[model samples]
Target: MVKKKFRYDVGILFISAVVLFVTGLGISQGTPQKKNPPFEIDRFIPVETCADCHSEIYEQWENSMHSLSHTDPIYNRVAKFLRQGLIDNDEIEEAESCVKCHTPVGFVSGFPTRLSDDLTKTPEIATRGIQCDYCHSATSVTKMYNNGLVLKPGHGEDDPGIKRGPRDDAQPDFHDAQYSKLHTESGICGTCHNVKHVVFGTDLETTYTEWENSPYNSPDPEKRVTCQGCHMYQRPGIPATGSTERPKNPGAATDYSDERPHIYTHYFVGANVAVPAMFGDEEKSNMARERLKNAATIDVDIDPADKKQIHVTVSNTGAGHSIPTGLGNLRQVWVEIIARDRGGKTTYEKGVLDAGSELPEDAWMFRTVLGDGKGNPVINIAKAREVLSDTRIKAGEQMRQTFDMGFVPRKGTTITARLLYRGAPQKLLKQIPGEPIEPQPVVEMAKAVRTF
Candidate 1:
């Protein structure tokens, strides 16, 4: 495509400019000045510009997870880590794939694909992340996943082109607007939410696929629940889905808009509390915690007749996909079970951390694990020989496990199942460059108590 070709030069020129700046040619006062990034630094249309007219939606999304997609510290460290220990051409391409979805603007501009580029020096628009213009300017989805949304972005503010949305009746004064049927469809969200490896051709993340096979995905037009239906419309206390009553959210979308009976909210909140907390966005972080708590349900039971075993059942009641939905390689979800006798003596325990804060061998991990050809665990998608295991509970599925006790349950024996989640595993976090992250917050999603 002509557009793809145009984007290629931007990275080269940007890199060259950085070289010039480092050598003092592009320096201004104390800061380095951008000497013309391709497509202008405003090709994506600055977030503040969109905020001028759509203040309320802008405010809602300003601190949302989507806004932090590119700037996320963990994402940056992990993505940048791919730049190291690569010799093959195919491996290099695999490393470059992260940008396609995380920074659509930079991906489109063909800059920052190298993975080694200093992101802080990139144009402001590229770092603004998955902002409004990139999503609104989408013209079509060329593929089912992996940043396949074909965009027809306007040439900056002067030629702000047609912006697409769910409403067919919208009439905006500032720019050309059109009702895009694709905007309402789950396929649009699938375009980026699903990730497939470039070389291995394996699906690393199947959030969209998981929903497609679930009961929530109905064929009937009136009954179909989309990614937007739950995620966009969710609030702090309310669950994303799986509840009997989902009250409509009603408000004016913008400052100049009239009140509507139902408007899809823009929090774009997910089950990720770590990123928001790291950025000091306490409000969003707490909302994530609430979302996680409401995402699943847990039940504990003892065999009345046998008295030698206990069962813990966890249901993926709320989510349309897997519970720990995104990037199973990074996310950790496990069940910690504790049992005690009459005098409060710890009779049985599992899911405790060892010296390095790593989960012990007996930890009941509920997530996917990648394996190399020779049966070694690997996190890099490019190096993955195959998926060895996936223990995460799928949508509408119940995962039941029975724990065996050496002795019969006493009359005062108490057992508890605490389902917990964390941002990443200790092994993966240790590989991150710079200061090591210790004592990551562990959130308890579901809890239960039983006595015999």
Candidate 2:
């Protein structure tokens, strides 16, 4: 009995030591891992650094979706919810998931080293702020979706010498000029443009694929343009070098070359005018409004008889990529058609946000919703279980919807079609139903075609 008791004690001691050893290794493995100084908060290169030289590209990038990716109010609120949800459940590690995209530098630099603080608060790291350096420095992308990124900071085949981009006339003050082929490729955008559910493996978004497959991507001469073509191209009036904003273009091979040609415009403009409008940048907001107007065209077909079918055809005529490019699950783009009769009677209406959760009976919606773990519908991206459905129009893709109604417009009746870009669907706002949503500006893509 004495011998047996002694052996049992020895065994217990051995097991405890083994467990301690394993736990130590696990803790060490999870320790902060910092790779390069560029990622370091204090060592980060600011947007101002790049703007000083590449003003056009810098300005364009500053106003782009990437710049606003983190600072965006909607994104901020969603991220807060995600972080809180994980923390409330003691899933602290999982909370870092959003930092990978919204605050990439902080994640890479070990600032979030732990979840006790707002990672974006690091001044230098904040300055980097998803600027040109971070993107231009990306080595490769490991996965096509869900921010599956593989970054290598040091110089490589794709490095723009010391400074990278596509410009025969580009001059560099800080580093050697090397044009990275990757910069011009669609893959650059795919790093974030495509998204997938981490748990379900369901494709949440695929803007890259949509553009690659669409007729709009048929190359410039083919009249198919790229995302860069529309977003980066400069307006004829927005001069590259002027007394207002001096041109950053330094290298010159020809006299006919426009200053805008050398430097990509930094307007980084898009359809999300609401946020900027909220921030009181009415000028930029108006510009964004116009950009949306240029994004698509709508055609209406209606018969002036009772119980007529109204067909609305929407085409992605301007967007270089899909009309709704990123975060397809949250982006909603559709047409609101209204038909009136000579007596000032309402004949048909669609795409209006109804008080009920259901969409208008006759309106076709270009949006998606997901099912939660319980198989119930969910529009909050933070709570997505699986994608229920998606029908966002792709670039160069055309969709026609028919609405059958009892009332028919008489001669001289007015018909109006308004194209809209809602950042998030109503279902998403269901969480806080009473709160006001940042209203997405509606653009009049087309006017009346005259009644039959």
Q: TM-score: which candidate is best? A: 1
Please list the residue runs of candidate 1 whose C-alpha ends up more than 4 Å from where it truly belongs after superposition.
1-41
N/CA/C clash count, model 2: 6
TM-score per model over all chains: 0.88, 0.74
Per-residue lDDT of 1-452 in model 1, one digit per residue for the tens? 43653464365347434543543332222111233223444566889999998887887787787888889887888777755787865556667667667776876776665456666666778787788998898877655656667777887888898899888788888888999977887778886887766555456787887887788777665777888888777766665666434568888767878888777777888777778778778878887787788778888898777778788899988788897877887688888888899899888888866678788877878888877668887888766656788888898888998888767967898998899988877887787779876656789998999987
lDDT of each: 0.75, 0.56
Error of 1 at 371 (Å): 2.3
Shift of residue 228 alpha carbon in model 1, Å: 0.4
Q: Which regions of candidate 2 deviate over 4 angstroms?
A: 1-39, 82-96, 113-117, 148-161, 168-171, 216-224, 234-261, 304-307, 354-362, 373-375, 408-411, 430-438, 445-449
Candidate 1 displacement at residue 195 in angstroms: 0.6
* Residue 8 in model 2: lDDT: 46
Give lDDT for model 2. 0.56
Question: Each model's number of backbone clashes?
Answer: 1, 6
lDDT of 1: 0.75
